[model samples]
Target: MTHQVTIRNTGHRFPAQDGSTILQSALDAGLVLPYGCRDGACGSCKGKLVDGRIDYGRYSEKALTAQERAQGYALFCQAKPLSDVAIEAREVRKAGDIQVRKLPARVQKLERAADDAMIVYLKLPANERLMYLPGQYIDILLKDGTRRSFSMANAPHDDEFVQLHVRHVPGGAFTDHVFQTMKERDILRLEGPFGTFFLRDESDKPIVLVASGTGFAPIKALIEAAFKKGVKRPMRLYWGARRPKDLYLNGLAERWVAEHSGFEYVPVISDALPEDNWSGRTGFVHRAVMDDLSDLSGHQVYACGVPIMVDSARRDFIQNCRLPENEFFADSFTTAADKAR
Candidate 1:
């Protein structure tokens, strides 16, 4: 049986089948959606149910606690509609452009950007192209029915191949393989071009781009795509790391600043080792943004990083800096452990 799911604000409609997840239905029907972990782990796909009931699949209490579920909050990745439904969420675009396909990809090259992060470039079929927005991600299907999600570090038009920034998580199943046993030219399954955290071309408001650790991957993609499209809006980037080495692409970002007149870069270090002798912007990177922009009422923010950092920054940006709820876009990279937690 099929029920219609109507998206509020945008009025976009999708189908919800009795046995399928809401997010799966949206994608199947060629509707763009906001989502992260396809599993019940990350809360990025949480949507408010305006008018319907759903049987929810297993989910982390942290993502959607029992109390929140009772209050009409549902995780789209885990929820199945029982009847016609209405929801409120940002309308998806290219994510709606075409149906997603599960394709085999060959690893073209792998380069280490930092001690913990690797930039893997993959070559897709010559005739097939992945049309995705700037800030989306893909899940590499593993051999054991598991997947590793990594943000696309390169934007759409530059697609001779897809680039992913994979941060090595100690003791992680997939990451251990990536760092230790994975080899170039190995065939892997890739399904994606997911997430709604992309540049809103409709808004020319000043942009605040923030990142911590490898979350900088998608932010870098967004920035490159923005610059390539000649998006001349004022942009300020605040990137934080523990030591100077953690800011892997500091030189590249500095060069970007020199070339891009409308862009600014702020590398923030929270714990600089004495050997580094680093005296730049220090402490929480998000705080650095607060220090500069006392009023964010007129700005749009794009943040990618750990959930705690993204959550904390979002709270402070809205409550203290006067930013609107809708003006902020984020993609929280939850660790595999965080996912299991």
Candidate 2:
């Protein structure tokens, strides 16, 4: 059976097959919905169930609490319609314009960015190009039928090769191989250009970019894209790590500050040792943002990081900082361990 889903805000309607997720159905019908970590680990797809019933499929409690479910909110990425439904969600435009494809790529280079991070560069077929928004991610298909996701660190204009900053997750099948054995010229399969973490170029508000660890992958792409397009809006970046050595691209970020008059960079360390002689900001990365900007109501925040950081930022910014909830965009980096939990 098929149920009709009505977008109450836009009056758009789509047909969803039984057991099919609302997000998949919307995409199937050529409509785009804001989403991240489609596995239901991120709440980016959460919206009001204006009417009707849904399975409210398996999801992380952090993504959708019981209270939120009771209030008629659903994670469209995991929600399956039990009947015709009406939902109030923001319609994303332009995302559906680029097609998602599976392509073969050759590992062109592997540079050790840090003790636990590897920077990978993959070259596509001679005539092929992946047209994607700055902050989208691609899934690396593994031989065991599982997939590992990583954001493209290179901007669209700098697409000669796809770049990914992969942090070594010890004991992880994919990351272990990437660190222990994967080498230059090896072939890998990839599919995607997924997520809704890109900048909302239409908004004129100043931008606040928050990132932690490898989450900087997509943020790096976003900043380069903005610069390529000559976006003049004031931008501030807050990047956090456990120690000074973990800030792998510190020099690059510093160079961006030196070159761009409208851009500023802040590096925060949470667990610095005395021998490291750290003098920069110390504490949670998001907390650093909250401390510096008492008022985020007039700014648009784009955050990418571990679920905890992303979730905390989303909650505190809206509640205490008076930020408009709709202005916050995020892509939560859910690891395999996170998914298992």
Clashing pairs in 1: none
Provide the clash count, candidate 2: 0
TM-score of 2: 0.97
Stretches > 4 Å off in candidate 1: 8-10, 94-96
Candidate 2, residues 61-116, lDDT tens digits: the string is: 87888999999999999999999999999998844578999999999999999998
Scored by lDDT, the top model is 2
TM-score of each: 0.94, 0.97
Best by TM-score: 2
Measured with C-alpha atoms, the lDDT of residue 136 in candidate 2 is: 95
Candidates' lDDT values, in order?
A: 0.86, 0.93
Superposed on all Cα atoms, the candidates' RMSDs to the truth, in angstroms, are 1.8, 1.2
- TM-score of candidate 1 to 2 decimals: 0.94
Model 2 lowest lDDT segment of ten: 332-341
